[model samples]
Target: MDWLLKATTPAEKILVMFVAILLFAGVMAFILYVSEKLPRWIPAVGFLLPAVIMLAFGLLWPGLRTIFDSFRDAAGRKSVGVDNYVTVLTNPDFQIILLNTLAWVVAVPLLSTVFGLLYAVLVDRTRFEKLAKTLIFLPMAISMVGASIIWKFVYQYKPATANQTGFANQILVWLGLPPQQFLLNPPWNTGFLIVIMIWIQTGFAMTILSASIKAIPDEITEAAQIDGAGSLSTFFNITVPSIRPALIVVITTIAMATLKIFDIVRTATGGQFQTSVIANEFYSQKFSQGNNGIAATLAVILFVLVIPIVIYNVRQMRISEGER
Candidate 1:
């Protein structure tokens, strides 16, 4: 056990992992072997016991510990009660972070879903539908860090007179305008970061919403056409109503993702230029500033924020399922 805990070399770490896997497998094998002779109810408990123990140790313990640490001081040695939470809510800097997070949550999902729905509608049965979707969905296949790095270069700034390397700045130079620092300016800089998220998420939104649109009954659409409904009227009156549940799912799902955004801000700006969200701020507080209490508080706040969105999403899903 000590050897496993203190594994230093790659070989030793691999050996330790292998040993742990073998031990887990052997234990499960024993449990299965013994369960054959056990009562029917006992077998179910036997199967679930390992999973419950793992979840308790891995998730429940860490979650409770984080909540506990939220009340401790910066050094995590003294009780500070709600001081960290107070500072987070009251401090001007944290206020900006909260606002930025709010902007991200609002902007990303709304814009992404709108763009996705529009694109999905435009290419629903087009000759180049596959190619068009592939172009947009290609970004979704890239890792968030990769997408951020790509956009970071695209937004890269240079002196007005100097040769511009960034595609956006180059275009600006072509228009005889001064090169703007997209990542350096506050407020608007946050919008630029939000674009990266929207770019990635739009693909996800389009795929889900497109499937929902296709699932709409042809008879309903044909009946609308048989009446006085034009293309625009049919879309608004028929398509939109039919896909409302999917729209809710997409918006809430993207909102949750936006709330937890860290990689884009971290990679593009290092959360500098007043662009930090709660996820990045918590990471900076915990590791960079060594303020565990505030970090834990932010973590708790993030967890709390996600719960309502998740609940709403689940409820919407259940309603959709019941309707089906």
Candidate 2:
């Protein structure tokens, strides 16, 4: 505290701190009044008002500003029309980022949902069901940064002839293969990161899918058995088709999460070795490089990318609702 007072320029520090304290106090009071004292409707309004105001201030305004800026030059001083958009689509590195985005959107969700559904089905009625589910679901409770740190060690690397100590590399060396840099290679490293996402998301998918699996009428499974359908056939024909809607929900949700996978890439590689994706690129362009227009364009592209998956999720949810 003394360091802050001493280091800070008096004029800037006092004024800035004064404003910060005022804002903090105002926000705290607003929260308490809404959360504790406000009438139900007023509280609902109070809770939502800040979010709406925040959306207006933080998201909506900036989105509109970005769209405007995308039309302007680097200085944000003159209109460049569609040139920035055109350049983004054509730029090679951005193109890789776009492709990387596509790969994430495609791979993580499908694998996670599939593995989740399979595991959910396998353990749904088993004796050790709770334990199995808990083990797999543990990663979902971990923060992304924490998960990234854990996997970073698992994918740890050392140069050739050095002792292979990374979890994966050690396994390889046990089999007499050379130590390898799992997170440093191009294209494949992207897949390695996708594995981390899948590892984390599979539990979510499994929990949702396990419920849907249980919700399958016991009569249906018994009838399938009486009809001479073996376990595998019943799972394929009845369980899968019956749970298709839930699967769709899992896939879509995971897909949306995958598109914004900044933490994994950022923490593991810092977007080096051609592993950059749209989310990391946006941060670099906007904050690191101070290219707000390009950042906005990237955000807009991501928004466009997410809308369809969201729509599909909504439609699947509706279908699930109708089925009920």
Candidate 3:
């Protein structure tokens, strides 16, 4: 127990991990084997028991504890009722965070979907389609942290006297304009960070929407064209309507991703300059400010925000399945 409790060497850690996995698997197999001799319901119960227990401890218990802690004080020693929630909801700084989060949530999914849909439609069967898609999709391969760092260099700033290395500022320099600090500017810096999210997520939207576009029956498109429909008209009336379900999925998925955006904000701006979103604010309150109560409150807020999107997604998926 002490060995398991304390940190160990890498080799020892690996051995322990392997042994634990093996033991768990053996226990499960033994349970199943024994259950086979009992009623059929026993095996069903055995199969579900481990997952139920894991979820109880891993997800349900932690969530309940966090909610409970949200009502406690910063130090977790005193109960404060809804004070933390009230402070978070009413604070001017956190208001900006909420506004920035709203902007990100609205902007990223809309722009990403628009760009992805247009690009997918344009390149669906064209020459060099694969190359074009691969180039756009390349950003999706990079982690959010990696993308943020790469774009941070792109948005990096220097005085007008020095040579600008940032691609954005360098272009400005070439245009005889002063170099600007993209991440240090308030109110608009959040927009810049949202662009990074849009860039990364566009590829995902494209891949999903592209597949959906391809799945649209050729007969419908042909009929639309034969009916004297132009490209734009055909796209709006036929293609858009045909892929409405996929569009919903893309929008909701991207919205969920945008709601939890943290890595890019942290990597690029460190949540300074009014660029903080809810997720980054959560980290700041919990670790930087040591406001456990407020941190838990923010966590609960995020969870609450996500619930509706998830439910809507599930409902949409079911409706789509029924339509099919």
Candidate 4:
């Protein structure tokens, strides 16, 4: 009370009084609104309207603008009428990026999901199953940047005749082979990045598949055993089929994520050594190179790639729900 009375200036007292009055009014207003004043949709629209407008602004408008920009020139000053698209599709570097992206889209999702599914099954019944799953799932908690840094150290290069520091090179040296730079190669270097995505994504797939596996009825396994089906046959015939829906979800989710992979490439190689994919290239062109049209084209391409996959996943989920 002494501190409150210590303000010499009348403006300070007024300012403090204004804030206290504002707070009191806000509390009263909230209570009144809860009692009767505000409309039912006020709160609903208050939150959801922003999100909806944001979707339209952030995602929808940008996507449409990108599609429009794809027709323009690099400078974005004049309409080039598909010139940017043609150049992107035809250029050898761009073609390599497209191909690398395709390889990532295909290989990472397939291999990771497969490995996850297999591991989920392998560890399902064991006493250490939870611990094993946790160990495998651990990588997923690390951000792509953190994982990239971790793997970067593991793949770091060193000159020959020097003590090899990179894990890959150190292992090679241990085996009496020459040290190798894992991030500097052309085609194989792409796989090194892909491996990181796989390591991160596998836990997600495994957790999903593990749940689906557990959801498989105990009676079904017993029935398979009664039918004299071998363990392999039972697994192949029962386990795989029962979890097909979850497998689809895992595969398509990973596939979509694989398309958007920029961090791994950016952090590991800075999109160098012919390793730039569409996402990284999008950033490189628009921001770094100031080629807005080509960047927009790349963005549009990514949008086109993602939309259909998402639609398919939603449809598959609905179908699975219907079946259940």
Assess every candidate by TM-score.
0.93, 0.86, 0.94, 0.87
Cα displacement (Å) at residue 278, model 3: 0.9
Candidate 3 structure, TM-score to reference: 0.94
**lDDT by residue for model 3 (70-119), tens:** 99999899999999888988989889999999999999999999999999
Candidate 4: minimum summed lDDT over ten consecutive residues — where?
41-50
Q: Across residues 29-145, which tens digit of lDDT does each residue of candidate 4 receive?
A: 665566464567666654455569879999888777878888888877899898788888999999999999999999999999999999998998999999999999999999999
lDDT, residue 183, model 4: 84
Ranked by lDDT, the better of candidates 2 and 4 is 4
Each candidate: RMSD? 2.1, 4.6, 1.8, 6.7
**Candidate 2 or 1, higher TM-score:** 1
lDDT of 2 by residue, 243-321 (tens): 8998888888889999988998898888998889999998988888888678878888888888999999998889879
> Which candidate would rank higher by TM-score, 3 or 4?
3
Pairs that collide in candidate 3 are: none
User: Pairs clashing in candidate 1?
Assistant: none
List candidate 4 segments past 4 Å from native: 1-47
Number of clashing residue pairs, candidate 1: 0
Which ten-residue region of model 2 has the weakest summed lDDT?
A: 1-10
- Count of clashing pairs, candidate 2: 0
Worst 10 residues of 3 by lDDT: 1-10
TM-score of 1: 0.93
C-alpha lDDT score of every prediction, in listed order: 0.95, 0.87, 0.93, 0.90
